[model samples]
Target: MSTPGGQWRNRETFVREGDGIVDLLTCKWAREHEYRLTKEVWAFRENRIAVHFAYEWHDEKGRWFRSCGNENWESDENGLMRRRVASINDLPIDIGASLFHWPQGRLPDDHHPGLSVLGL
Candidate 1:
């Protein structure tokens, strides 16, 4: 999703182990205003799918903020996200860093968060 007034109509999705290319666009739910995935780390364990990701967003006032955490996603044979349970941490970055993507030609700066260096 998205914010009530942000109008985040553009988006893309990537399936695991599938090219890793983010060219598939799907934004039917773009008007939801209050749901999204920020830092997704996932894996399969037996019959379940586990996920960990950070969620950062803005309030109705347009103030950007973040909450970091992990989650559990269970699916049926079709591999769809279902029955999600999660926990959230309220800690924001102690350092004011500019998050970036170096692989996309963004250069390293003193404020870099290093996610790009780790190939995230």
Candidate 2:
């Protein structure tokens, strides 16, 4: 059984799962970042693991965002995560805010704040 990582897979699979959002991101950020995880709170059954974790991501410049909240994983017998569901509110820091933060074209930071603007 193949484990499910955050948007990790071949291009075709990603397109199928991602609803053709036109995302240029490769599989670079697929797996869970271990350093962010504060603890594995509990495991109710062999198939279910409850955990508390801090999740963060860096932009192209390597500036990491504030660690976010916990997420849960429910795996099959093979320990492959078949179902991953998490309710993430929002982190306080806006050091790196996604373009979606605004209404498509209303960002105060030059109307677009991303790699293209920074000229990565």
Q: What TM-score, computed on C-alpha atoms, does each candidate reach?
A: 0.44, 0.41
Mark the regions of model 2 whose C-alpha exceeds 4 Å error after superposition: 1-37, 61-64, 90-120
Error (Å) of candidate 2 at residue 6 is 11
Q: Report, for all candidates in order, the number of backbone clashes.
A: 2, 0
Lowest lDDT 10-mer window, candidate 2?
31-40
Alpha-carbon RMSD, each predicted model: 11.4, 14.2
Give the per-residue lDDT digits (tens) of candidate 1, residues 47-67: 466665544444445444445
Q: For residues 14-105, could you state the per-residue lDDT of candidate 2 as single tens digits?
A: 33223332242333354322123223364566677666544344555545453534456666667765555554433434545522343422
* Cα distance off (Å), candidate 2, residue 25: 8.4
Clash count, candidate 1? 2
Cα distance off (Å), candidate 2, residue 49: 0.9
